[model samples]
Target chain A: MKRYGEFNALNGASFQTGEDARVVALLGPSGGGKSTLLRVLGGLLVPEEGSVLVNGVALPKDPEGALEALRQNGFVFQGYNLFPHLTALQNVTLPLMVVHGQSEQAAQQRGQELLTRLGLFDHLHKRPAELSGGQQQRAAIARALAPKPRLLLLDEPTSALDPVMTGEVLDVIRELAQEGQQIVLATHEISFARQVADWVVFLANGTVQESSTSVKFFYDPMSSLAKEYLTALTKYR
Target chain B: MPNSLTRRLIWTFVLIAGASLLLYATFASVHYPWNWSNAWSYRFQFLWGWGTTLAISLGASIVSILVGFGLMVGRRSPTTPLRLFCHGTVELLRGSPLLVQLLLGYYILANRLNINDPILVGMILLGFFEGAYLAEIFRGAVESIGASQREAAKAVGFNKVQMYRHVIIPQAIRRALPGTTGQLVSLIKDSSLLSVIGIEELVQKVRIMNSSSYTALEGYLPLAAAYLIVTLPLSWYASRLERRFAFET
Candidate 1:
C-alpha cells in the first residue's frame, strides 16, 4: 500500500482474527480508508508499509500475488456489479476457467450449482439487466462464494438498495454467516449490523475509532467518533 | 406516407441517373466497345486484381485487430515503460500518413531488410496502420467498462490477464465491433491506394485497361461498378451489425 499522493486512507489500521472468523463488520463514514484497507487486503492495491497476514503467513503480491489474494478471498461490492454482457451463468463461471483451471464443463456445472443455491437458477441465462436488484446482489454473492473462499470482503453490501431489497440482501448475508465462513463487511447499515455483525469496527478519519462486540458497539460504543456517527445515523432513522 | 414518398422519389431518381450514365457510356464506347471476345481476357485480370485488393484489406484488418489489441493491452500494462512504449507506437502510427507508411514499408524498409514479398509487406503495412486506430477504439471501450466489473472479476479470483480475457475483452470487443466494421469498410476502400505501388489492384487494373484499349468509358464504367458492388453490401451489413446488437447501450 504505497500511494504517492497526500492522503493515507488506511492510517494505522490493524486487525487480527481467527481463521474461520465470521462477520467482522467495518463501519465507517465515506472516504474513511475502510475501502482502501479492503483493497490492500484484496491485493488490488499495495500499501506502502503494511503486512497483510492470513493464518500467520504474509500475503504475496508477486506473479501469482493477485491470484493468491483472489484464491483466499471473495469480494462483494455495494453496487452488485455483474457483467452486463454475460448471462449470470457466464459471469460466475469465468473466473473458474481463467484462474482455477477448471474445464468449461466444470465451470458451467459449478456456476449452475452456485446460482441455484443463490436462488438464481431460472435467472442464469438472462443478462444482469433482466435481474432485480436483490437478484443481482445474490448473483454477486454467488460469484464471490463460488469457490468456497476462506475469507470474504464485502464493501457496503446493501448501501445502494431500497429498504425491501436491503432486507433481502441482509437475509442472504445472515444465511452466509450461518454457513461459518469468515466475512469482513464494510457497511452503512446500522440495525442489520447490530443483528448479524459478530464484532463491529467503527472506522473514521483513517483510523480505528472503536472495535467492540456488536452488542457493546450498538449499546455502548467507546469512541466519540463512533458515538457521534451512530447518533447522526439514528437521528435520520 | 411522406417518408415513403421521399424514399420512392429517391429510388426513381437513382434509377434514372444510372440509366442516363449507361446510355452516355454506350455512345462513348460505340467507337471502340469492349469486344465480347476480349472481355474474358480482361475479366480474369480484373478478378485477380480485385482478389488481391480483398485479400490485402482482409488480411490487414485481421493483423491490425490482433496487433492493436495487443498494443491496447500493453498500454494498459502496470509497468510504466511498457505503457509508454505502447503509447508511443500508437501515436507514431496515427501521426504518419498511411500512404507514406505504405511506401516506407513496401519499398524502403522491405528492400533494406531484404524482404522481397510485396504482398506480405503490403498486408502488414495496411494492417499496422488500421491497427493504431483500432487500438484507440479498443482502449476507449476497455476504459468505458465499469470499474465495478473489473473489481467483480478480480474479486471472483481472476488475476489481471484473467480479468481482461474473461471479463474485459469480451465486453470491449462487443462495443468495439460496429466501429471496427465501419473501419474495415474504410480499410477496404483504402486498399486501392496500394495500386500506386504496382500492386495491380482494381483501380490500377482499370487504368491499364483504359490506356491499352483507349476506351475510357468501357474500362472505367465496369470498374466503378465493380468497386460499388464489392463495397455496398459490406457497408449495408456493417450498418445492420451496428444497430442489431442489444448490449451496446
Candidate 2:
C-alpha cells in the first residue's frame, strides 16, 4: 500500500491484466487511487506494502530494479509536463540523446519522425507554452513514444483538455491502441475507455472493486460498487 | 500616436536632466570651494585603484558563484553531515556583518594559518559572504520547478545526475538569473568594503587622495561616478540576458 501522510492512496489494491489484453483501463471516481495505482505499476512509486508483478516477474524494490522497469515503460502525465525551456523537437530529442545515449543525428531523426506522426510537425520549433493544449499533449506523447517503450502508462492524459482538444488526444491514443501497443490507462472518459480498453479494472476507496473483461464489466458488472459507478456515469447517456 | 522608442527616449532625457538639475542645486547650496586640480593630479592613482577594484570584483564574482553552487548541492545532498555543514556556513556568513568578518579573517584566521596576503584573503572573504546569499537564491530557483517536472524526468528513466543535467539545471538557470544578477550587483558594491583590510581598491585610493588634497567633494564624487560606471553596464547586460533567456511562459 502507498501512504501519503495519513491517507492510504492504495490499500490492498491488486489485479492482473488479461493474457490477451492490449489495453487495460482503470476506471473509478476522483481520488479513488487510479493515478497512484498507475504510478506504482510504472515503478515511479514504491509502495509501503505489497508486491507488483508485471509480465509474471515480480518488481524488485531496489533502485536499480525500479530504474530498469522505468526504462521499459513510458508514462504520460495528466498535465503534459513537457520541459518548458525546450522546443517540441528538443523535448523529444534531449531525453534520447542524454538518457538513452543516442547520437545527435539519430535522436533528431527519431524525434522528427515521431513528432510528425503525431501531427506536431508545424509546431516542432515552438516551446510548450506557445503551443495549444492539444499540441502540447501530442508533443508529450511523441516524446514518450520516442524511446520505443514496451509498455505505455498514461494517467488521465486528456483531463486538462477542452472537448475538441480531448478528442484530438484520444484519437492519437486510439490509433496507438489499434497498432497493438500495450497500454495501461487511468481515465474518467467512460465512452472512450469503453471504445479502447480490452480489460477493465475498477477501483474505489483505494481498493480494487472489480476486474473483468471490458465486455463483461460494461454489459454485466458483478460488483455493487462497479454497478453504482457505471449507473452514476451513464445516468444521462 | 507616439512610438514607444520616442517616448522612452523622451522620458530618459527628462530624468537625466532632472537629476543633473538636482545635483547642481545641491552643490550650489553648499557654497564650498571647488578645487578639482589638486584631486586631478592623482588621476593615475585613481585609474590604478579602479582597475584593481574591477579585477577583484570579477574574481570574487566567479568565486562566489562556484562556492554558492557547491553549497547548494551540498545542502540538497543525502548525507546529513554535509547538509548541516553547508547550512551552518550559510547562516554564519549571512548572520554576521562583512566588516567584522574581514577583520576577524585577516587578523585572527589568517594569522593562525600564517597566510599574509591581504588581497587574496579579502577576495575570498567577500566571495564567501556573497556566496551565502547566492546559495539561497539557487535553492529557491531549483525548488520552484514543479514536482511534475521531476516525475516526468524520472518516468523517462533518468538517473539523478542525468535528470539534473538534462532537465532541472536549464530551467533552474533561467529562474535564477534575476536574483543571481541582483546578487552580483550587490557583490560589486560590497567590494569597496574590502578597503578596510588594506586592499588598496578604489575606496582606499579615494581615502588617500582625500587626506592629501583635503577636497572631500572632488575626491569622493568621482569615486561614486567610477562605481556607477561599472554597475550601470552590469545591470544593462543583466536585462539583456533576462530577455534572451525568457521563454514564452
Candidate 3:
C-alpha cells in the first residue's frame, strides 16, 4: 500500500502476470492508479506493504538496489521527456554509453541504427524542440530501446499528442508489439488497447477491477464496472 | 560603412564628448586640491590593486561555484535532515550582512582559528556569502526542469551521478547562466568591502590617494573606470552565452 499521510494511492493492488504476455495494457480512468501501478511495477516507487518482482528478481527497498532492478526495464513517460539540450541521437546514445557501459563507437552505431529504424534518420541531429511531437516521442522510444532492456514500460505515451501525432507513435509501438517486445503501457485509448494488448488489466479506485485476456476483456467483460468503463470509453472515441 | 555602423560610431563619439564635459564640470565643482602629478605617479600602484581585486574575485567565484553546487545537491537530497541543514545554512549566510561576516571572519574567527592570512580569509568569506545566493539560483534552475525529466532519468537506469553529469546538471548550469553571471558581477563589487581589513584592493588604493592628494575626482573616477573595465566585458560574455544556449530551446 502507498499512502500520502491518510489517503492510499495503491491499496492492496495485487495481480500476477506470466513473462510470456508480450503486451500488457493498463487501461483505466484518470486518477485510477494506472500510472501508480506502472511506477510500482517499474520499481520507480516501492509500496509500503508489498513487493514488486520483475524477471524473478525482487526489487529491494534501498534505492541503489531498486535502480539495479529497474535497469532491466525501459520506461517512456507521458510527456515524452526527451533531453531538450541533446540531439535525438545523443539522447539515445547517452544511456547506452553511460548506463550499459558500451563504447562510444558501439553506442553511436546502435543509436544511429535505432533512430534510422524509427524513421528519424533525417532528424537524428535535431534537438527535441526542433522535432515535432511525434518525432520527439519516437526519439524517446529509441532512447528507451538503446540499452536493450528486457521490458518496456510506457505511461500514457500518446497522451500529449494530437490524433495525427498519436497515430504516428502508436504505429511504432504496434510494430514493437508485433516484434514480440514485452511491453506494458498505461492508457485511456481503449480502442488502441483492444487492437494491440495481449493481456488487459482494468484498474480503478486504487485496486484491480478486472484482469483477463484482451479478447475476453473486450468481447466479454466479466465485471460490470469493466463493461461500463469500456462502453463509456468507446462512446467518447 | 553600413548605415548602422555609422550611426553606432556617431553615438560613441557623442557619448565620449558628453562624458568629457561631465568630467570637466565635476573637476571644476570639487573644492579638493588636485595634485595631478601625484595621482599619475601612483598609477602603477592602482594597477597592482586592480590585479589583486581580480585575483580575489576570481578565487571567490571558483569557491562559490564549487560550494554552491554542493549546497544545491544537499538541498535537493531526499533525506530530511540533510535538506533542512542545507536550507538553514543558506538562510543564515544570506540573511546576515556580508560586512558583518567579514568582520567576524577577520576579528574573532581568525584569532580563534589562528588563520592569519587576510586575503585567504577575505576570499573564503566572500565565497560563502555569494555561495548562499548561488545555491538558490542552482536550486531554482534544477527545479525548473520538468519533474518528468528526473523520472525519465531514473527510468533509463542512470545512477545518481550519471544522471546529474550527463542529463541534469549541464542543463541546469545552462539555464542558470544569466543569474550566475549576475551574481558574479555582484561578487566583483562586493570584494571592495574586503579593503576594511587592509587588503589594499582598488577601492582601498583610491581611498589612500584621495586622503593624501585630496583629489576625490581624480582618484575615484579611475577607480570607477577600473570596475567598469572588469564588469562590462563580463556582462557582454554572459549575453553571448545566453544566445549560445538559446539554440537548444
Candidate 4:
C-alpha cells in the first residue's frame, strides 16, 4: 500500500486466498491502489500501520527476507519493457545466471531452450527494438518464466497491446495457468479476467470492494462500488 | 546578390577552417633544405607516423573506457567510503587541468618513482585524464535507464552485481556513446600533447625532426597529414555509432 503524502493509497486493505486457486486477478479502477498493492507485495512500499503476511511471514520486519520473497516471485509489467540493447537470449539468461546460480553456458543453453519453446528462437539474437510488439511480450513472459517462480505477478499484462496481440500474450498466460502455476495479475482486460481468472478482486479507492469467484464477481457483485467500477471499466473502449 | 555571395563565401571559409586543418609536418616532409631523399621515403615516414598516432589514440581510448568503467562502478557502491573515494577521484581528475595531470603524472609520479618509461607514463596520464569525462558519460547513461528497469531485474531475483554485469552496464555503455564522442576526439587530440612527455608518438618524432632538420616545412607538414589520417576515420565511426544507438534507443 502507498503512503502518498498523508493519504493512504491502500488503507489497511486485506486479502486471502483459496487453497488451490491458480489465477487470481486484482481487477480495479485507476487510483484504487491496484499498482500500489502490487508494489507492497513486491516489497517496494511499507505501510505505516499493519503488516503483510506472505507464506506465513509478516513483512517489513525483515526487509531482506521481503526482498528475497519478492525476488522468488516473478513480476511481468504491462509495457513488456525489455532492455533494448540486449537480445532475447541474453534477457532470459540474465536472471538464470544471476539468481539461480547457473553458469553462462548453462544459462545460455536453458535460455535457448526457453526461447525456442516460446517460439522466439528465430528472434533470439534480435534486440528488443527489432522485435514486434507481440514478440517482445512473449519474450518478457519467457524471461519471467525462466526462473520458475512459485508466484507470477503481472501488472496489467495485456493493457498495452491491441486485441490480437493481447490474445497472443494472454494465451501464453492461459497455458501457464493450465500448468498449475499460481498467477496473480493486476489487469483491466476484463475478458481475460472473466475467462481465465479463478478468483477476482475488485478494488476501489485503495481497498478491495469485493472478492469472489470470477463467476460470482461478474454475474453478481455484492458491492455497489464494484458494480459501478465494472460498469465504468466495461464501458471504457 | 553580392552581399549574399559574400556570406556564402565566408560560410565556406569557416567550413574549410573547421573541417580541414593544415598539417605542420606535411610541408616539413618535402620542402626546404631538409627535404626527404625521395617521394617513396617521404610516403614511408608519413605512413609510419600516421600508424603510430593511430596506435596512441586507440590505446588511450581503450584505457579510458576500462578505467572509467571501474570508477563508475565505484561511484554506485553503497559503502560510504568507496563512494566518496570514487567521487573524489572523478572530481580530482575532472577538476584539475588535464595538461597539469599529464605533467604531474609524468614528472612527479613517474620520474621520482623511477618509472623511466615515457610510453607507459603517457598511457597512464591519458587514461586517467579521459576517464573522468568517461565516468560522467557512463554514470549519466546508467542513470537515464529508468528505475523501473532495475526494479524489474531485482524482482526477477538478480542480485545487485548481476544486475549491473548483465543488464545495466551494457545498456549504459551503449547509451553513453553519443556523449562519449567528445571524449574520444578529445583523447585523440590530447595524444598530441604527449609529445612533450618524450613519447615518440606521431607528433614527438616530428618535433625531433623539426629541431634537427631546421626546416619547418620538411619536418612538420607530413606529421600533420599523419594526424588527420588517424582522426578522420575515427570521427566517422563515432558519427555512425551515434546514428545506430539513436535508432536503438
Q: Number of clashing residue pairs in every model?
A: 5, 0, 0, 16
lDDT of 3 at B127: 96
Each candidate: what lDDT? Answer: 0.80, 0.92, 0.89, 0.79
DockQ for the candidates, in order: 0.50, 0.82, 0.69, 0.44
Candidate 1 docking classification: medium
Ranking under DockQ, best-scoring first?
2, 3, 1, 4
Q: List the residue pairs that clash in candidate 3.
A: none
Residue B67 local lDDT, model 2: 89
lDDT of 4 by residue, A66-156 (tens): 6676666777887777877778888888778768888999999888888888789889999888988888988988888887887788888
Give lDDT: candidate 3, residue A50: 83
Interface C-alpha RMSD, model 3: 1.4
Better of 3 and 4 by lDDT: 3
**Model with the higher lDDT, candidate 1 or 3:** 3
Best by lDDT: 2
Q: Pick the candidate with the highest DockQ.
A: 2
- Give the candidate order by descending TM-score: 2, 3, 1, 4
Per-residue lDDT, model 3, residue B133, is 96
lDDT of 1: 0.80
DockQ of the two-chain complex in candidate 1:
0.50
The sequence of per-residue lDDT tens digits that candidate 3 reaches over residues A1-237 is 777679898886887765567899998778889999998988888788888766666689888788887887899988888988899999999888888889999999999999999999999999998999999999999998888878899999999999999999999999999998989989988889889998998888899888878888899988888888888987856
Writing each residue's lDDT as its tens digit, candidate 1 over B1-249 gives 569979999998999899989987877787664454444458878788888888888798899998888898899899999999999999999999888988888788889999888788888888888888899889998998887777777677776767787778778776887778777877888888887666888778878876775556666667767777767888777777756555632
